[model samples]
Target: MRNRKLFILLCLLIAVLVIAGCSKTKQTVTQPAETPPAEQTTPPKTDTSTPGSGELKVHFIDVGQADCIFIQLPNAQNLLIDAGNNDDGQAVVDYLSQSGVSQIDYLVGTHPHEDHIGGMDTVFNTFNTGKVYLPKATNNTRTFEDVLKAIKARGLTVTPAKAGVQLVASEGLSAVMLAPNAASYEDLNNYSAVVKVSFGQVSFLFTGDAEEKSEMEMLAGSGAATLKADVLKVGHHGSHTSTSPAFLRAVSPQYAVISAGAGNDYGHPHREILQRLSGIKVYRTDLDGTVVFTTNGQAVNVETR
Candidate 1:
């Protein structure tokens, strides 16, 4: 009887040990593994895949003694300022085509001068133009008439390019008119439209052919404080009649661009103007061919054709 009792106790102890082992194994198998944390990152401001998230390009086309600028905005929009002389129509069109431009969001004539608006009719006829901005000043020349006819054909109305008018006012970009502040002026050049474009920290001033009179008016008005720019399209193609010393002082541009033909008769880019642009870096279409400036809201890179 003692032997049998001892045998039963031994069996019970073994069974208890086996059951504990099985319970521990099941617990170990049911538990989950630990996971690691993910890494963090910051995205860049400029992303080409999204609209308004890219660099800005300003192309100063070589139009020979005339003005024709094409601006590729960060928002994938295009702006054309002047179109050179009438004979330069085809050249301007070809240049725009090669640049992959199908439409012009803004078209500015600046003034009624033949050299400024001469090829405007060609541009209006060729591309799908958005808003046409012209100063209130008008001329009786055939060039001006042709532009009007083209606008009528396209069923597009004119938006006065005058003081305080804002062409674009968006986050990171702004284009405001600062000149032609008055309704009438003695010289036709005073009627030229002056546009100031600000892209983040970089700014550009485009003065078509504004003379001293217009410059003075801008200085005397609310626009004076905003004249400073990184680049200045020298007024009147570097003529002595424009870009007055006071005006230059106010603008305080780091770079100046003069658009004139090589060996032109009018003696553009005059000595007086060169002397005034002493410290500032200068680029001329006659020498640089086509000058391009690309900016990413902070830094600027320049290229010449």
Candidate 2:
């Protein structure tokens, strides 16, 4: 009887040990594999080439012995100076349209010369205009009367573009009227609204047919110290009466631009004026077509088409 009980107990112990081993194998098979870590990466660097400066473009449109300048300000605003001859109205409008300009933030009629403001009426009719600037000078021609009618239609008032007037005064840009100093003058050209625009290190001087008299007055005025510029729009299409030696000395421009027609009757860009600009680089609408000057407050890049 004792041998039979011992045999039964040994058999039961062997069965229990086998079951425990099987349970351990099942747990090992069901376990998941461990995951690996992800790889690291570096980021790209930022561009800081032109710090705190924006692009500014000044377009000198070719109007054939007439004056028409379109400025694309650093603040994305547009400034239109003059509008060319009476026949150039549609061409001027088309050019502006192609350039993606729908509105003019500032409209300037310089003096009331026919070549300067002949198309002013058309411009007023076409674009949505902001501030209108004009010299106190007036003309009795039909061209000037048409411009007045257009102004009345638009309900826009004229702002006198005279000395001490500030057109733009921002952090990185400044445009101030430096001419039309005297209230009255013997010659109408003396009423030309001369403007000085400075952006960063680059500057431009726009003289609207201003003759020697106007230049002399500006030099004697408070704005004489600010006459220095990187680029100069030669006055009266580089006529001898304009761009006097003293005026050129005060400006000290590195580049000079002349707007005149090819083989025109006026004999524009006179020999004397060309001699005066011998040392400086010269660009002419008559030869170079439309010229464009782009700046970033530090450097200026020029493009001609």
Candidate 3:
């Protein structure tokens, strides 16, 4: 009887030891398997917080010899300022399609100049324009006529854009029209629809061919307002008449984008202006192709195509 009891006790001890060993092995195998999934999940969380990754974007298309600026609001709203020259109409259309832009929320023609308003005809015919802003001026050019006809055909109204007017572009973007006041100047460049767009901690100034005359007025009017910007679209393709030293000093942009043709006849992006913009990062579409400015309301990054 004593031997039988001892045998039963030994058997019980062996069973407990086997079960404990199995439990330890299972924990060791399962722990390593569970750890990798946790590590894998951490990367995506880090990626989302990266700067410029989740921010709004602005694309300055290289429509040689003219200007076409596409602003993508944080909410995905679209704003187009001038569509290059007539030759760029089809290219602009193709670009918008590729970028998934089916409609334009706000379309602004800086002036009646062909290079500024010509490609707009194609844009108007192709997409739905919510509001149309144009300089309060007229030109009898066929290109301007075509743009007008398209706007009328679409039943869109032409509104004059002026300073002090503010509108919401997206959740974070605010648009302020800053040119074409009642006080007239002899030059059409003075009438160009200048715009100052602001978002959290960042601001951009778009001078649509506005020359020294308009820049002076803007600076004088905004005395002490501090129009410093993160980005500046070089006025009049960096022409000598635009981007005056005083104006550049007032705005003090961090980066400047020059939209000019390769070997343009007008001598765009004059060397003097380039020199005056010393210490500022410059991107020229003629050399770098399309320039894309992207920001997450904190910092802006430039990418060339």
Candidate 4:
């Protein structure tokens, strides 16, 4: 009888323990999958301005007695406007090489003037030039012949630039021809290819050797009575016959550069033009060597070498 009672008690204890474990297991709950925090995800940023950022530079070289402006494109291409007088060949070439240029995309001779196109022969022979731009006219001279010979020898083609046509300087920069418009003239100065370069919000006016006639005509054609520019290359090296008061009021450039040789016979940067631009800051190659303007699309800062 004692053995039977002990066995029944042990069985009852085992059943109670099993029932308690099942009850606990049934009450226990599982957690659902967690959602990720919203802040962990972000969109990438895009730059909308200065498409040519970090890749383009424009330089207004100081070649004595003439002008040579170089535009370096982001694509590693080059565009040179004028090459100074014949004597500046070596200097111009050295400058281009120092600036890390090995080839030229375009060479623009505003007109057939010796001062504008003389050193181009050296450039064509030294580097690979894609094309050469000359006015749709010419004033045949030795200087012109030299330029022609260089182009021909290099097997390069000549393209005529006309008013209202646009040329690319860099990815976002554009150069628009503004003068030598349809009306032919006897004066070489009148045939100078005036160009306006626009990059971002700033603009620069490059009037090769345009005189009063070209300025007046350009102003009349705009129909706005005025042309606004952030910087201006003073026409004909700030000659009295160019940059007339009326034209000054029209363009109203904040900064002007005069590319004239020291003690040149022309007596450029005349007092009259200086007086007219008394309110604006002026830079002269005669005083400073090479003048450079750097733009971050919104503003332009100038530096001299």
TM agreement with the true structure for every prediction: 0.84, 0.83, 0.81, 0.79
Residue 127, model 3, lDDT: 93
What would the per-residue lDDT of candidate 1 be over residues 200-284, giving only the tens digit for each residue? Answer: 9999999999999999889988455699899999999999999999999999999999999999998999999999999999999
- Tens-place lDDT per residue, model 4, 122-240, is 99989998877888777669888988999999998887776786677555667778877756887888888877777777778888898998888888875323267888889988789
Under the 3 Å rule for N, CA and C atoms, how many clashes does model 1 have? 1
Number of the top candidate by lDDT? 1
Q: Distance from true position, residue 159, model 2, in Å?
A: 0.4
Q: Report the number of the highest-TM-score candidate.
A: 1
1 versus 4: better TM-score goes to: 1
- RMSD to truth, every model: 5.4, 8.9, 5.6, 7.8
Model 1 poorest 10 in a row by lDDT? 33-42
Q: Over all chains combined, what TM-score does candidate 1 have?
A: 0.84
Clashing residue pairs, backbone N/CA/C < 3 A, model 1: 65-261
Error of 2 at 136 (Å): 0.8
C-alpha lDDT (0 to 100) for residue 251 of candidate 1: 95
**What tens-digit string does per-residue lDDT give for candidate 3 at 64-182?**
99999998877667889999999899999899989889889989898888888889999998998898998778777899889989999999999887777565655566888877665
Cα-based RMSD of candidate 4: 7.8
Better of 3 and 4 by lDDT: 3
